[model samples]
Target chain A: MGVIHVTDRQGQRHTLECVEGWRVMEIIRDWGLPIEGVCGGACECATCHVFIAKDWVEKLDPATDEEEDQLDTVITHPTSRLSCQIIWTPDLDGLELTLAPANG
Target chain B: MTDNIETDVVIIGAGPVGLFAVFELGLLDIKCHLIDILPKVGGQCAELYPEKPIYDIPGFPMVTGQGLVDNLLAQIEPFHPTFHFNEMVESVEPIGTPEAPLFRVRTAEDGTTFTCKAIIIAAGGGSFQPKKPPMENIEAYEGTGVFYAVRHMQMFRDKRVLIVGGGDSALDWTVNLQPIVKRLTLLHRRDAFRAAPHTVEKMRALVAGGDMDLHLGQVTHLKGKAPVLEGVEIKKDDGSIVSVDCDVVLPFFGLTMKLGPIANWGLNLHENLIPVDTEKFETNVPGVFAIGDINTYPGKLKLILSGFHEGALAAQKVHRYVYPDKKLLFQYTTSSTSLQKKLGVTA
Candidate 1:
């Protein structure tokens, strides 16, 4: 089991029991945090975008070109990525993800 | 000049096609006044079904109607068109200019006249009137128990919410409210769902997870009185009444908003749709146009994708109507750009 750490915009931190093979968007919203998965994670809509801490970002797999293009359109404080593309695993424990704005 | 609001053009409907016309005409910097009866600019979309997903519209693979409307609003936001809502257009008469002719659009609610050089009546298939529930006490339940939108997600946060209808909108709403509402019950008049495949899959997953209940039949009656909606009585196909307890009732049976004012506007209406020329989507009335599901051309497909096709074509004609000298130059941008725009992901 992987333990994922999610920090919402309101400074609420949640340590969730990350089920294996679950997408990051599902894990966050399942815990009752706000994440507009508007397109239901079809990869067509970029509503479920998030920002991963740079230190742990390299530990995770590189985002696909499609995901990168989606990130380019989003307005982020620093950087943003689509949470639906990230899969949870045991090695990925302590993954710090931040919620993003809806304009992406 | 009775409360005269003058513009070079007046686009009567703020629908997908109507808004597209506004954007297209904006390229020429021709002023336009966009009016819609709904509280929002998106006509049928914002009024009829904001939650339903649109699969036919090209590009983005798939998108909710609300999502598509947001993208459309963003596309036309740069045009900066004026908007007036909650007011119906009562009449349209010629307000002749010394050099050219104009139209005086008189609205009913507020007797204000909007004068414009040209008019594009791109009303998408009549006013979309939502089919409301038959509960007599439903009015008393508004804000107290019932709602048209999911305004207070926390109200139904841990309660059973019953959704009526089997259409695309109904199905999409179930999926949307499923993760939010504690338990969901989808009551359909029929056993089938006209929603897309992905939405159906998600609902099926919810059902498998014991998070939802699917009641396949019609709602017979309401259970409670003021300040509460206890349960709904649904009559199954076998002539049996099944009473299911619920916190809130949502009717998504779709709209009955027929073409209310167009018949009086001097346009030929054939079978509830505006009859128009095949190539241009223009009505019998000069300087007027219609598009989308509300229109029927000799070869019109009546899809959102097709409406975009008709819209771009009509804009070119309207460009010619406004600027007779620029007609030939406007012809270069006249070809069908709907598929191209969607394919190229331009907008």
Candidate 2:
């Protein structure tokens, strides 16, 4: 079990009790904070954009190049990342992520 | 700055059906103002499958969804119709005589109000929007990596792209992204595709090509973290569980559309759709015409070709009713070219 800290674009922090190996998008969508995973956690739609916690950024794995290219097209901050690419592990118990409005 | 601009006609919803009205009316030398909630034109055709192929629309043998939009935009450009993008009509009330009742159309954007002699509701079945996945905590990976539609296919290029759903949207994307994305995985909860046979054939070919993987089952379990989509657990029909390391996941399940602001007008709407139709496309209220998906005509087909036919026909009918003094020109055909050309020529 992993307890990830997710913050919406509005700076609202959600204490998500997520299952290990579950994608981060699964956590936010279940809480119902208005993050439309239009693609349902696929890297195609890019509606599930979020910013990772700066402190824990080093601890997280780097995004693949393709995921990076997709991120450029979406309306997001420099720290933005697509949530579907992220998996839940017990390691980063306090991971912060912020919401960004969809590019549509 | 002006609250309203007076025109001979007002078209709500600047989608393909709405723009088609402008193009058709332009041919008749009729001026109209088009309104929609989108920031620009193209509507659903542009939004849904800009890169995907569309076979239903007539002409050119075949064309991409965006290609159809391009052709439509070209046709409507000559008319120089006024467009109020990102604006929606709150309500359309009729005012004046039977020959030409001036319409009081309220718009929320810019707070500008429009009053036209006639209103043509060329809004399609509705504006299409990406549907959200039902999974909890799905939004947590917002920027990280989650998607609905393929707004940017190149981004997933040279990477593992995992897609869910056995429908047309899913299969079509799988076929398109096969060459771009390094590896593609097609997951369907069913044994067969609901899409036409031709598309399924294309997908099967791709799977056989070895560039794509076909996982026939449900994603019963998901495994991931802050930076990597290391693996996913798929629940197979045979009770076997498979885990995959995916770089990206694209779900093309389906689309959800809204009835625009017309839903709030309170005009005896049937399920927020199905407005009462009197003749052709006229709604329960006079001077207020509902065309395309927004209207429940006796036997209206929801196809773009059909919607365009209904909308164009409704516009012409309204034109005659609005301007009794004007003479009707051109012998328009009510039967679809597909029907007429096929049934008449073939039969």
lDDT of 2: 0.70
Model 2's number of clashes is 48
- Where's the lowest-lDDT run of ten residues in candidate 2 chain B? B338-347
Off by over 4 Å in 1: A1-104, B96-101, B130-255, B325-328, B331-347
Model 2 RMSD vs true structure: 16.0
- The alpha-carbon lDDT assigned to residue B203 of candidate 2 equals 90
Worst 10-residue lDDT window for candidate 2 chain A reads A69-78
lDDT of 1: 0.72
The candidate scoring highest on DockQ is 2
lDDT of each residue in B180-213, candidate 2, tens digit only? 9878898875566766788889999877878689
**Which of the CAPRI classes, incorrect, acceptable, medium or high, describes model 1?**
incorrect
Span of ten consecutive residues with least summed lDDT in model 1 chain B:
B336-345
Per-model CA lDDT versus the true structure: 0.72, 0.70
